[model samples]
Target chain A: MSEAVSALNGQSFVGIVKIEEAGPQGMITLRGDAGAAALQKAARDVAGVDMPGIRGIAAAGDRAIAWMSPDEWLILLPHAQAHEGVATLRTALAGTHHLAENVSDARALFRVTGEPARLREVLAKLAPADLHPDRFGTGEMRRTRLAQVPAAIWLDSAGEARVICFRSVASYVFDLLSVAAAPGSEVGFFDA
Target chain B: MLILECPCCGVLADETELAPGGEAHLKRFGPGASDDEFEGYLFMRENPRGVHFERWRHVNGCGKWFHAARDTSTLEVFGTYPAQTTEPPRDIRDRISARRPGWTWREFA
Candidate 1:
């Protein structure tokens, strides 16, 4: 059997911000009425997080729910349990208008970790998203263009950010982040 | 350089984040219609140098289509509304009227 490997083979870069491939994530694309009680329960039971508000992301331990669109959410869980997670959600929301599909292998993710200000500076160079700590904080996610590839980012804490993009563009995004986070390239744009 | 609000995501997105979708509120003339009507429908578009309605997709934000009313020359956006609405909301129309009195774009005045 062919074993699965992370898109970048766990490549990592140490700079102003530590950029490392998040190996083997369990992701599910769940589409439904975010306000529906059934969905709220299903997600809470499965991911341990309630329905996030607009552009909101809530996490508890290894489980998370991210508001993707008006009616879509991305659920994150343990890498080994993605397929089982989808079956559980579909069974729970069977009667409702909903969709749950495994997307763990279809996407790539990276964790940018360092001082909050330095991490924000690294992202600001490659994305147009407002990186001001006051404006964007923990529990909020922004779907925006990173350099040129479409990517979504969320700050789990003041010092760490998680970025996700299509699997095919993982290397491209990694390169962009590496150059943006290079030690001397710091523009100090986000330093308070 | 233009930043427009997306009603779907409720965010002001940069022009680079949006994809222009041309004029909005076009009446479709299908196969049953005369050639002139179809030609006008397919080819004729509002090109007023002043107030105009346009469709835009927030490609990088929420990925939803929305409408924008703006001045062609000045690039001043009167307002933006959700794509589901058939016509500009009263406030958007009234705002344009207040700023550009007697201005007409297609059937809107």
Candidate 2:
């Protein structure tokens, strides 16, 4: 294994919202016919979890999967398991019209948790998707732009948002989130 | 800022999240067609004052391409539909007719 450090290694920001890298997680991009039973079985056999439905996420132990588009899903797993996971999936899906790429190095992930209302305000400024819990609660995922950069966002069970952006723009996303989470920077409705 | 709902994902995508795809339901004039036919298909577009149909892609959302019907003058959206069909859906046509009386665009009257 190559010794590749994370983009924000040894760096973390804290304020009303705490921002930090989610460690080294494996990411895989899965694309296929969602309704096909064979694809579903293969995904479950390889990832140890059912593929998530539209705008939904399914978590099984250490692995989690998020629905990105109609026929696309993002699978997150332990770094050590990514390689084996991809090979297993490829074999399982042999002769099928599908693609399973190991995107572990393509994306950077951050976990953001804080005052719900404050976090909502910050996300609203960057993304157009409604961050209100009623609209974007747990299990729901969206592929949207954050500050002109493409990202995938979703809330965990604890209401903490997991923001994933391309590795190339990881630093920019981190800085933008830090600025938004800074003290006294959160613009309340009355202030707006 | 115009917001068009993506029929596939049901997301009300903002103009920034969506990419405009010019006119919708256009027929192609390929080989064996007259020069005028090909030219018309390639360049000519219906720039109406009201009740226009166009294509849009939810670039930052579901990444699905869809169609939207709206009035060019007022910016009032009639509705959005899937891109699989060759023309706008019946329900969207009815909605446009209800809003703009006696408007004619394509086969919809």
Candidate 3:
């Protein structure tokens, strides 16, 4: 608990709360025209992974998670390997009909793990992401607003989910989580 | 809140995420497109009262713009699809079955 408190010191906080050390996670936003097959191919060529066909998320190993869309996808990678991954993607996608932006430093991540019901209840306060089995199942990702803040939610195969938001909004969101995680709650940040 | 159903992100977004573009399926008249055509393109709106189709841009969610037709009276959204696509959603077959007495789909079109 003291360690957690120490980690969040001097960071922006509007209310009294506990903070967990969220280790680095790499986030990259990709944009392009939907008809750019060459860009898609370039993405495949760079990542050595095919894009997910469904309107959801596709994870390739522990290194990255790709959220599919008609014209864009947000790729999240492990902290240490982010630079290499982005560099490789940029290299492979050079001259292609797409743009890849490395935004790893722009976002903050929080892990919410516990009994499914508790997490769901806390999330219901602000999350607009559908958590139903038919919608956001395991391995699925949603880009929606939580407490009016743009957030990305992803559920791992193990049912552990992570929510990523802008760094400026992290403290406010963390306070909301603290209120939600009231008594008998075990919530902490992940140290990368 | 105005109900907006996006074609790509499915039917779940607030009116805050959408910008309405009046009526759908407008025809361009004339070669240079006269002032009337310009008026049709700029100012004229169908002011539909019943089942009407309109264009909406999903500004916040998918960022892809699309079209949606809905009944203002019943609030039943019949169809929605990508704006650039030629064919709209096929589910409108049963939705437009019974038309309102004075309001015609042709008037809104």
lDDT of each: 0.90, 0.83, 0.63
Candidate 2 local accuracy as lDDT?
0.83
Candidates' chain A TM-scores:
0.96, 0.93, 0.75
Q: What is the lDDT of residue B64 in candidate 3?
A: 68
Tell me the RMSD of model 3 versus the true structure. 6.4
Pairs clashing within candidate 2 = none
Q: Largest TM-score belongs to which candidate?
A: 1
Model 2 iRMS (Å) reads 1.1
Instruction: Write the residue-wise lDDT of candidate 2 on A103-158 in tens digits.
Output: 87888889888767676776777887777666777888888899888888887754
TM-score on alpha carbons, each prediction: 0.96, 0.95, 0.75
For each candidate, give the TM-score of chain B. Answer: 0.96, 0.95, 0.69
Clashes of each: 0, 0, 2
Model 3, stretches more than 4 Å misplaced? A1-21, A33-49, A157-159, A184-192, B1-5, B14-22, B26-32, B85-94, B98-103, B106-109
| TM-score winner, 2 or 3 | 2
Model 3 pairs in collision: A20-A189, A23-A192
Per-residue lDDT value at A161 in model 2: 80
